[model samples]
Target chain A: MAMIVDALSWVFLLTGGFLGVSGGIGILRFPDFFTRLHAAGVTDTLCAALILLGLMMQAGWGLVAVKLAFIILFLSFTGPVAAHALARAALHGGLMPLLHRAEDDPSKS
Target chain B: MRHIISLTLILAGFWLLLSGHFVPLLLGLGAVSILLVVAIALRMDAFDHENQPLHLTFRFTPYWVWLAGEIVKSNIEVVRCIWGPVSAISPTRIHLTATQRSDVGKVIYANSITLTPGTVAMRLEGDQIEVHALTRAAAASLQGGEMGRRVRELER
Candidate 1:
């Protein structure tokens, strides 16, 4: 049972790490600011949740698990609010998004 | 009255969970601090139902589970959009009318929009929210009103 639990925890940790890395790459590669926010905000919450869940499993039934749960809850609640505020600020600052229009050719227009 | 009781309980529970020390002196200190915090909150007139929201505890769990699923699905879509051709993303501004009745519900709806990948609620005025979506598909999904409906359900 202990071996199985350890293996499961490893799987979760590795997957969470992979997601986090991909999100970082997405933030760098995305074209504009808003899309980059999408990359950062979405995966940040889920990746943290997954990693903390793995840690909670490893912690077993204890205060550590409770603390991990609290952290996850806090992140989920705050992440969106922060994203909203950032987007609002950017919009107020007149950061227009680069819209992909159909009539505009990629090379010429 | 109920709000005050719930807030005090929540604060005390948080203190116990965070401290993890059962010594009499530490516990006594925790109690005093919690009381002080509650007193300040009450004096500020921030102990209303909207602020505390103890009633939504039971309704929020299922909404959270569904939201987690939505987040995972949208995250995959966003990852693909990032790796795929840049032209695939069509950034668009959308105006959505929030169907929620209360300010709390409207805030939840807007936050949920911002929480999901590819969509951000940029401005909220009255019952209308201005949003920016990374792609047309995401904007269409927001127009579908599933999340708004879920938030309305949560309000009840």
Candidate 2:
């Protein structure tokens, strides 16, 4: 059971790390600010949650687990609020999103 | 009265869990701090139904579970978009009408949109939320209004 738990923890940790790295790459490579925000927001919350979950599994039922759970709760609540505020601020600053065209704009194509 | 008791209990429990110290001095300090905070909150009139929202406890859990599932699903989708070709992303702006009656509901709706990965609630004016989605599909999903409806349900 111990070995299996360790292996699972490693798996979660590695996957979370991979997601974080890819999110970084996405932020750098994505075209505009809005798309990059998506990359950052998505991975920032989920990656932290996964990594903390892995740590919780390792810590067992104790103070560490409680702390990890609190961290997860805090991240889930604050992450979205911060993202919303950032996006709202950017919008107020007149940063227009790069929108895809379909049938509305005939002059472009 | 109930809100005050619940908040005090929660704060005390949080303090105990985090401090992990049973020393008399620390315990006395913790009690004093908690009381001070609660007194300040009472003065601020922050114990209203909307502020504490003890009524939503049972419903909020299931909503959180559902939101978590949606977050995970959207995270996978966004990850694929990141790894795939840049052209695969069809960025779009969408205007969604929030059906919730209260400010709390509207806030929850907007936060849920932002939490779902591919969509960010850019601006909220009255009942309408302007969102920037990473893909057309994501925009369409928001247009479906399932999240908005669920949040509206939470208000009741």
Among all candidates shown, the one with the greatest DockQ:
2
Give the chain B TM-score for each candidate: 0.94, 0.88
Cα RMSD (angstroms) for every candidate in the order listed = 4.0, 3.4
Per-residue alpha-carbon lDDT of candidate 2 for residues A15-104, written as tens digits (9 for 90 to 100): 888889878988987899999999998677888888998998899889989999999988888998999899888877877667777532
Q: Each candidate's DockQ score against the native complex?
A: 0.48, 0.65
> How much does candidate 1 score in TM-score?
0.91
Separately for all candidates shown, the number of backbone clashes (residues 3 or more apart, or on different chains) is: 0, 0
**Candidate 2 lDDT over residue span B11-115, tens digit each:** 999999999999999999999999999999888885453577655666898899999899889989999999999999998887789889988789889999999
Which window of ten consecutive residues has the lowest lDDT sum in model 1 chain B? B46-55
Give one digit per residue, the lDDT tens place, for model 1 in B1-156: 888898899889999999899999999999999999989988888545356666677789999999988988887788788778878888887789998998988998998898888888888889989887888899899999999999999986
Candidate 1 lDDT score at position B51: 67
Assess every candidate by TM-score.
0.91, 0.91
